[model samples]
Target: MKRLLIFYFLFFPVFLLSEKRDVYAISDGKGNIKLFWLTSPKNYPSGGWRIEEEKTNKVIEKQLYCGREEFLNALKEEEKGLAKNFIKIFKDDDKEKKGKKFLIVLEAMTNWNFAQAIGIGYEIKDVPKGKVRYKIIGLDESGKKVGPHFLSDFLDSSVETLPPDAPENLKAEIILREVKLSWSQPKEKGVIPSVFFNVERDGKVLNLNPIIPSGEDSSFLDKEPPSLMEVNYFVYGVDVFGRKSIIKKISIYVPDLKGMVPPENFTAEEKSGKIILRWKKVENSSGYIIERSNLSNSLYEILTPKGIQPDMEYYEDSNLQGGSVYYYRIHSYGRDGKIGPPSLVAFAQAKNQTPPPKPKNLKAKVGRTMVQLMWDRVDFPVAGYRIERKAEGKEKWDRLNEKLTPEPNYNDITGLYTQGKFKYRVIAVAYDEKESLPSEEVEVELLDTVSPNPPRITNIESFDGVVKIYFEPSPPEEDVFNFLIVRGVSEEDPGLVIGEPLSKEKREFEDKFVKIGQRYWYRVVAIDKKGNRSDLSSSRDINV
Candidate 1:
């Protein structure tokens, strides 16, 4: 009994193992290998095993599997041996031939165990100079299969290339200020078409629409035109295949001031010793009326009747006195008693009748190294006058005096420091201080003088990022002189003085520092070598 039991345990398992079959094949596109195994009647599990390449050797991917129908279907469709050659045998021959085939795809270029178990195979298509490969593997019954096999040789690799061309029948139109667009579908079936349109104005992209379906006509009216008034626009087109066509420009004119009356060009200016007013012709104007006022007056006086041409823009005011200022305005009256708003204010000053009086003898004198000038005031009861002077080397005379009194004599003659000869002249003042005819001038030469007094520092103040020092330069005999600036932070630190010995005529200096939010105190003084130094100017304190 013990011996029989031992034989039964071992023999039963062996009998079951023989009932199943493992089948596989290899393919290199052009050729194929197959296997067949004799087996007793037994049902195999629906899934199968596979083998693939890892650089060199054929490796098994044990757990890797696929459905029978899917495996067979992939083989028939692709004609790739990797999946089709691996078959599961059954008791019925016809059923075996018709069973589905599952093709298992494994990631190439990896060391994964399951990927190795399935043999790697590929299908190839024409790509440039080389073949474009799609990888696949196989699965079979008994959970044992071989190959991701190469099946490129089995495929038709010939392919055709087409030149890029515009999508057919592309058209765009503007409707009610919106752009409506349409285009023909691509020749290649199942190709997704994309469309793009842009609204352009003055070579600028005013609006853009992208990624629309082909064969679709659409409108994109710009709700807001580029400006408050009307403008022109153009349309551009592009198809899904990235083909673009020339732009179609369209002009759109928007009316300005629609239904509103146009304004006439009303102008006012001084002419013929009077205020003249003019305007453009108004077709239906009843007549034009002129208004006048003084500088201080606010009321306007109408001076014309109806039925007069609004185009007869000219109007003159002769009832004004000389040297008087006046303001004028105009308006249009319709037959319906409608009056336009007052035109812009026009102003004119009456021409001057009084002549300017002759300037008195103008004389120049030398004081130390400086030239002192004096003249008799203008004789007329006028506004004012100007003075002019020129040196021997100068080509043009310069105005040296202005707005002198109406008295008989005046004195200036200051700021002349040059040693050469100089000439001078004066003119009378007219209306509004306008200078009139010139008076004869006298020539004079300035004498050289000794150095002037040095300037003195008066006061100092410090503020944010800067220190301000104030001083007065020494007054010299010659008024035409400039001053130099110098500064120092500490009173006792002579070495810390910032600049060379500055001119005594300098009045102020500002120093900048990097430190902030600090308090500083400063002092200034005025000195003149020719004159005594004034007492040190007041000191100032500031925080920066």
Candidate 2:
């Protein structure tokens, strides 16, 4: 009885383990393997199962999973509970196929939970490659039982190049003004490792760059897309080797925008010679358009340039008539070029303090004894014209007309004898004494003078055989066509003409005809463009 009792205790557990069947091995995608099977109803053990290599007769990985929760926790997060729904509807025909879903033995496998599935996996570093065979042994309160063996076809353990395959089942979920995309990875052999994807919308790339999906589940969220009414999305899978697969496309409709808000807090004020308008910035607005009318309900005309940028909140409308009642309205534009409703109409009466517009097309005519200046009349009412003049190349402008002149033309009699250039400007003065900006300046040349001021000998140094003379040309040097160098022995005697006339710019002359050790007198006279010569310059004596 003692021998029989000991034998019965060990052999009874082996007899129960013999009932467990359908044991199989699966690769966990990592360098790991897993084992699963179903045991007879009400026969599953209290302790978990142990996976063993059938060929080597060695235990590879062991785990204690006595319940469904413990079985799922033993697998990777992505693989956990993946087959639960399929297993719930599993039938005997599911085990007949070559690539089939097998049932795993769970701790809940009472008579009612007979079909409950469970799985456990670990790193396969200890197992050899090729046709891997594994068996599951049920661990009970007694010793573990060596269950029946199942085989899996050859699994290539060597590293390989995995080509990226087309993404599957692309779905876009529309949120307000945005979209969220999710998809499944390609099937087994074509699945890419560490793969990323590029997102395109309506044939245009949307993402700043390509991106890898977060977590093992493939998904991408588009926070801020374009402003289109409908969007078509395309996702392209690309592997680390830059291989691109066919695109996964989906179309979705987004909620239409309510349009940009009209400009707010709009106000206008009369400033120096212009109407200054200001407003608060509008959200999602590309720019603002301003309009104005002389009277309320009158035809309003666009006052701002098209596409005027809204970045600057203030705009100045210049040249507006003073003492005028102006009605103004403004509207904001969206990026799509749709205009929003106009803001509340704002009105302001421009103060009656502005001067008339500046005179245009100013004209100056030189006369024998005076200069006559004329300009286009200002269209509006003006008190009179104010004339200003400045010498050529000079910045200081002196008023030529001491008092306002009723005529648009002015006669400059004071500078009639000055043989140089002078610039003239015209400004209109309002009845209120406000002065308009200066007109485009007009330059006048006073070449009516018949003769230029005589040239003066600046230096009369004598060379070994020549008298080198230097002289400064007279005022209105541009009018001096040439110079006549006169030679004589005394100031009382009129000097004889020297060599050919010297040009106004060529003031220095080398009198090579002069003899050394002789006293000679030199004088110079400037000739004007009219061929008139001036009185002789002061004589200078030089020993040559």
Candidate 3:
């Protein structure tokens, strides 16, 4: 026999009967049943079995077999022979037609045995779709001394073969007002066999009936949350034929709070002439109220106005006395105006108005598109430096930096098209946000003073004692005024001027005063009318 044959009906009574959990049966097609009931009795006449046809009100007799393993194993030869005859007597009566259906009952009576017990069972058939009702007859042996009789609860039997698999991965979470549960559907071959699910809490049925999931949903929320206690939940999938799957279970704890929790991470600092206070916010609060005290322990007063939002975490006290230490404490209130416990005291010193010394040795360099400025760094604990600029003749200096300049050097790269003399000044700002006197002004003139591009020295030749030079002039004559030719004994020496600056119109110059076997190096520079000088050209060498 297969394992399913061995185990499928091994515990069928528990699933089919309303009054007994251990009694079970399996039937052959010809109306013969191999029923198994795990029961025993010491005496013969004291214990028996009863069956009832609920629809016709007919009572039938069922023989109680001594199915104890030891008793069956130890049967003598004659006893075994007698059991064969008893099996014939125990067969169903001919009145029970094979093809007809009837509401039937199976009742067990171990009441007279030393161990008193009684079980009554019922089931709805055609296709079983209901719960199993179970009840113990009695607890004492005297209570079991009754005669055989039919149990009234039996009604039918079912032949359903398949039940859904258990639900997977059950989860539970406790939120503000509800306990949420989620689970995956059972695995099936083609389509879902589930008709609904039954939910339970601590073994008590929660939904009045099986809960039908909305289109393809797998989650449910329990709005009627349990009290402050650990609660267990169970979800069981029930198929269309009322076959139930194994249960998915989870447990969660619900917390009970008496009042609101206090704020956390409170801190205070003096920044930009104001006392800034901040702390982590608490949930479900109306707003936070800040208190200030001049003395360390007394004279605290509320500093915030009413009706502030609950999410605000920072407050600024701009009316603080300069150079004085202010102690602060904060508390959150609910919508009902009930205040929570006050936070730990925090203190900060208001900044003074005295400023640090001004920066010195300011310098400016003007470029085509930008001007770079540098100055001595301040050693005092100042906030930062402020840079301002204006036209040379303008009285008011417009602020150049959007915020305080944190470094000693800054590049004025914002406005470049306005050309002329520009004057700049920098001031040191103290922690109290007081600006010091402006440093000495630095001016830069922005005019077109670029020199013309240089010419190339193409080649040089020396014949006899005279050196002749050839060159190429690239820039227009209107931009270049002249070129200066200088000679050097070696590459590193800046020799005397070979001649006055050469005219732009002249591209080459001949050095006639050269001795035989002497070597010389020569370079030229182009000078424009604005007095701006270009870089030296490529060097040429001559040996005569």
Candidate 4:
């Protein structure tokens, strides 16, 4: 019984398929009118069927369906109601040979709603051969039906479908004060959709209609500036399906600060020979002006027109007098016509000056064998001075005293040879230790008056790792003015050693560095306690 039941179910579908009619529908590509025909079922015994379209319950187009003859006649009648000239009807036989399929185009009819009226509908029946059948249906130009060619039907059921009500929740978001806005795009199938956004500000909509590419961002920049004060605007989004979303509104506010009171905090200062000024920067101040004047004068000068930075605490007045005093002040201005009070008074004094004059009447003289130097005192305070002398025809001058008395006179005649000519000069010095130019030079020659005999050698000793050769001049009053010691390897050829100069009243003299086994030569010259030296005595060789 189950096998029989399965057999009957399969056979029942075949019988029903055989009794089904083959229907075909077509449009003239332009109107609300459509033509449809149905072949009579074999058992039903009807030869053909008729079709009709109605609006507001009134028939718009009624026709009988036959073969190609009836299809062409119905298409001609429908064309009368179309506003556009291009009209066509596709047939099954024509599509089969050309590897094409039946296509229909129908005009959209308005049922009182303008947004809903702008659409076209098409239908295709008997798609598959024999017992199996399919119908294809679609909509075209549902909004703003202005174009010539549009999609009306789907060839396959697997093709993606789209929503019938366009996109919902279309909105505009004002992202910033610069009139930047964003919106949501429409969702559709089979075709990549494009979006367009319109912006309106200050009662006038912007003329730029920007097309948003597929999958691109849905934001826009409203570069057009709005009016002063608060502004109003409207925005909307349009999709590639000729569908437009609802409008959105936005408001913006702009402020003014004119005629407002400005604040103050300006200041100034006085530095070396200059006036420096500065002021505190106002929040919106364009710039500041600096004015200056001498405390004793009435004329004031503007220093800087552009306001200074609030943190730039100081400025310089590089043109002030060296010994004169000056005063300075500063002022600040703002864009709101506000003026700041003058800064505190600042005073500056110039520097002092006092320079020393040169010395005068410098002279040098010779007394006996000593050279005497003298100079007039300088009016200014001074440290001790120096005396300089040079022998006649010598290239270098010698300093007699490193730093002598503050007095103007000096006697520097020691260490001079008899019959030798010499020159002498003096220099005056100031408290800062600055020395004046040298005094006028005086040249003099010394003459031998008397001679003193050589003293006897005595008291040879060694001290501090050094050998000291001492001698005593005979007759203490006699002047043993100068002495000489010479050293050599041999006594008979002993070389003379030079000795430093000594005073005439001195009795003893010490010679340093007498090495053992080395023969040394000694000679002493003396005058009878006078300003003279005796002839060299025969050499004395000392061995240690």
Give per-residue CA lDDT, model 4, range 1-544, as digits (tens): 0011111122122111111223222222222212221211111111111122211222222211122332233333443223121122222234442221101111111111111111122233322222112231221223221212111222233232231222334343332224455544444333322234556665665745443322323455665444235656676554323334456666654222221113344444454435555544445444445566666356667766655654455677675444455665655544443445554555555332332344567665655656666777766555666777787789889988866667878877554344567777766665434556765667767654546665666655555545565666666543555555444556566455556666654555565556655555565655543456656555555555
Tens digits of per-residue lDDT for model 3, 347-379 = 999985456789999999887778899999876
Q: Which number leads on TM-score?
A: 3
In TM-score terms, candidate 4 sits at 0.24
Worst 10 residues of 1 by lDDT: 105-114
lDDT of 1 at 217: 42
Task: Give the C-alpha miss distance for residue 54 in model 1, angstroms.
Answer: 96
Steric clash count of candidate 2? 2
Residue 436's lDDT in candidate 2:
89
Question: Candidates' TM-scores?
Answer: 0.23, 0.26, 0.38, 0.24
Output the better candidate (2/4) by lDDT.
2
**What's the CA RMSD for each of the models?**
29.3, 20.7, 18.5, 23.7
Q: Order the candidate numbers by lDDT, best to worst.
A: 2, 3, 1, 4
Evaluate all candidate structures by whole-model CA lDDT and list the values in order: 0.44, 0.64, 0.60, 0.43
After TM-score superposition, the amount by which residue 8's alpha carbon in candidate 4 deviates from its true location, in angstroms, is: 56
Give the clashing residue pairs of candidate 3, or none. Answer: 18-133, 111-144, 125-157, 517-544
Question: Where does model 2 exceed 4 Å of error?
Answer: 1-45, 62-119, 146-153, 159-166, 169-179, 182-220, 224-282, 288-544
lDDT of 3 at 259: 23
The local distance difference test score of model 3 is 0.60
